[model samples]
Target: MQFTLDDEPRFPRGKRSGIGIIGCGHIVQTAHLPAYEKYGLNIVGVYDISEQAMRTVQQRFHVRHAFASVDDLFASSDIEVVDIATHPAERAGLILKALQAGKHVLSQKPFALDMHTAQELIQEAERRHLTLAVNQNGRWAPPWRITTQLVQQGAIGEVLAVTHLFDTRFEWVTGTVFDTIPHWAIYDYGLHWIDSIHCWLADTPLTSIRAREYRTPDQPMESKADWGMWCEFVYANGAHAMIRSVGCSQTQRDGHPFWLHGTQGIIRGSILGKGNDFVELERDGISSRYPLKGQWFPDGFAGTMGELLCAIEEDREPYHSARHTLRSLQMTLAACQSAEHNGEVVPYEEMKR
Candidate 1:
């Protein structure tokens, strides 16, 4: 259950990235805190909107400072970066405040409520000469990471289409704060898969998207959103990526798998969720199998932080910076709009508002 990196230091005492954490929610406890510990990063302090939550996190994680106010956390000279784990509603303001104070920020996604807010945050970060990283950690899932590398290496001559299929009951919603999230399955959880496709097909720009969200009567009407969702994404190169997932199916267990077809080869695999998964590439009647190591939970979390560390040291943007992940946000919002509009085929360009 624990995934922290090392009891021994990887760098000299003063050399690791100095991080000030700005949220103490579920993800911070499960993923971010453990990943930071594993990387041997220097955590300067911790803060939360709730005074009690802030104090609890400090004690639980052995954090150095339990900041009295958001401004107090921002003013820390030892804090060179802010790792923001707040919800989308609050994330933009926190990112803006941190950038204005001259601190690099790594934020959770859906990076913003909408694309315009995301752009505003990105622009301010650029103006301040600070890196604004989007924690699209799901891209580091072993199956996804390997497949992306394989396609880039031309192991697949030319991609034709991609299909991602997932079926699982979001039973975890029964007693958690996520139980209250509107469109909990698609808007909240589905963003992970949508963002992954953007990364898996980095070369092709998505041009069109049509989507729908639905729920059967048995599903809890916790919010005004659906438990089952579908989307078809089209690229400028005439390629298509389709996503079909159901999180409220009373007849199904959990499954996460993907299929990718190319002119010269075919790829099929499942993400780390099922534990027993494989990536098989078939070409010219020959089959090759690649096994994956590390689950997405903490490993992907570690990868996100590691990229930011490298970006800081090399004076460059992380591969999935806030500006870079704007594509994912735009696509996700299009899906939402399409579902609301009765599955109308919405050109991705129509979302530019």
Candidate 2:
């Protein structure tokens, strides 16, 4: 079978949109800078709390300027869009500031510290007519994104169930702030799949979620976050998605990480970063396999900035618009609440209200 990326990018090339970045963290160093360069946008300005961090990214990525402070970066007349890659705790303020400054934004998720803050930032952006996008870049992961296309093409008939089990101890924990957060091990890392599953369903509205979270006894005791999460998600259209994750698994092997069963067909693949990484769609007793380019780590980063830039050019909302991702945020938050409430099913309607 011909191997095509999930979708052809319709972003207009030769259009250099001015981009400013706020955080010079791990993601900004690895994915965001490379992706911005790859997608035809230049980082006109950047800011971080540490001058050293700001200078490092500035020189490393050859970014145009390192602002003395975030306010200085925001004040730059060249910057039209601000990429706020700061930690979740700091995101709301940075996002609200950018929105009020009349600049479009692509902030890191979980962008909201909570739904109320999400709504506040969203409303501010809306009132200003500025595009605010969450970097739910998992939607661009090859295997997951490809499966979405096949499902939408009716190759999979209708998506009935998508069960994704990720049972691997993420080895990249030691020297970061992630080691400290309570739910960071589960909710933080697990958010990719949470957001991706929503994307896989093609943004069909969600209805409710029944979720349970706990720490596995055998799991390594590192973070305060639960090491496991079993989520049963119900969509408004009657489709369902389930996520069973063991973030601290030691002995188990996660061979096939995802199984998406549809009425007419099914897709099987692994999203274990940099792992044959193929999306196999089997329908009507025939099987076809499509290969992927790279992991979501860096490749997925492309679409985050690319979509925002294209939306600016097209005069429309980005594919990862903040309004749309607000549902994903609410679902995740409701799942958090439900986990706290002994796995009680949380109706999204109640939370949205």
Candidate 3:
């Protein structure tokens, strides 16, 4: 297909929207900074607890000012939006503070550590009437988008079963090289896949979830486990989906890592591979690849930011609003609870309480 920059949507020019990026980490360097730069969103300031980290990002991105803390960023007169790129544990508090400061927020996934906090954050945003969104950017990824389009277009007929397989050998144990963060496996990497499934399937609230978990001997942290999890989700429409994440697997595959079996066809995709790596739409004897267009990091981030800004400008909810993202968070937490209870099926409502 022909690629053109003009085909992409343009943001309103000369508006000078100031964005304050908190958390100078991997995601900030790879995704957020490049995205803000692409959309022409004026990054009025940056913040991180580490002075050295702040200096690194500011020097790399040429951002003018760097604040010592989130509080300082919130107090900045130039910043209009606060992008929370911090770890999952700190995300809720930072986001809540930003919202209270009268700034819009776009945050990384797992929005909170658990369901209760996720619900509380949502309520606060609604109460304040602020534009709160989560960075569940995988939905906008070309392969998943194409898969959803085909499924919705009935190329897959009636969807029967969905199977997701996410396997990785990267051991994330606390107090080790991979143990930089508190929670390992599921919350870190698996959350993205869970969110992608929920988003791609039209934000279906899981009716019930059953799961299982495992731990490895090398894992040092008491809480950290080399997990093998399986979650069975019964959607309201009666569609059944199974998601499995095996950290003990020998292979290191990534992304959504899933297959959808419908009455007439099957659609498959992965989020963690190269060109044409995530495209598998086959029905009858016909099949074709859906290639990802445009650049990866900046393009994906730019698309998300554009949608968010447009939503704010129109007083509408962005495509992946907090309310929608919360369903995925609920699913992830429900799966964790089910695994803790020996694969006992846990209903979504019960998990909330």
lDDT of 3 by residue, 139-189 (tens): 666566566667667777777777877655445444453454323455565
Alpha carbon deviation, residue 214, candidate 1 (Å): 0.6
TM per model?
Answer: 0.91, 0.91, 0.85
Judge candidate 2 against the unseen true structure and give its global Cα lDDT, from 0 to 1.
0.78
| RMSD of each candidate relative to the true structure | 4.5, 2.5, 3.8
TM-score ranking, best first = 2, 1, 3
Off by over 4 Å in 1: 1-14, 221-224, 249-253
Cα shift from native, residue 184, model 2 (Å): 2.5
Query: What would the TM-score be for candidate 1 when compared with the true structure?
Result: 0.91
lDDT of 1 by residue, 107-201 (tens): 99876898788888889889888999988888776677777777777777778889988766666666677766765666788888888778767
**How would the candidate models be sorted by lDDT, starting from the highest?**
1, 2, 3
Separate clash counts for every candidate: 1, 1, 3
Give the top-scoring candidate (lDDT).
1
* Regions of model 3 farther than 4 Å from truth: 1-16, 172-183, 203-205, 216-224, 236-238, 249-256, 274-276, 294-298
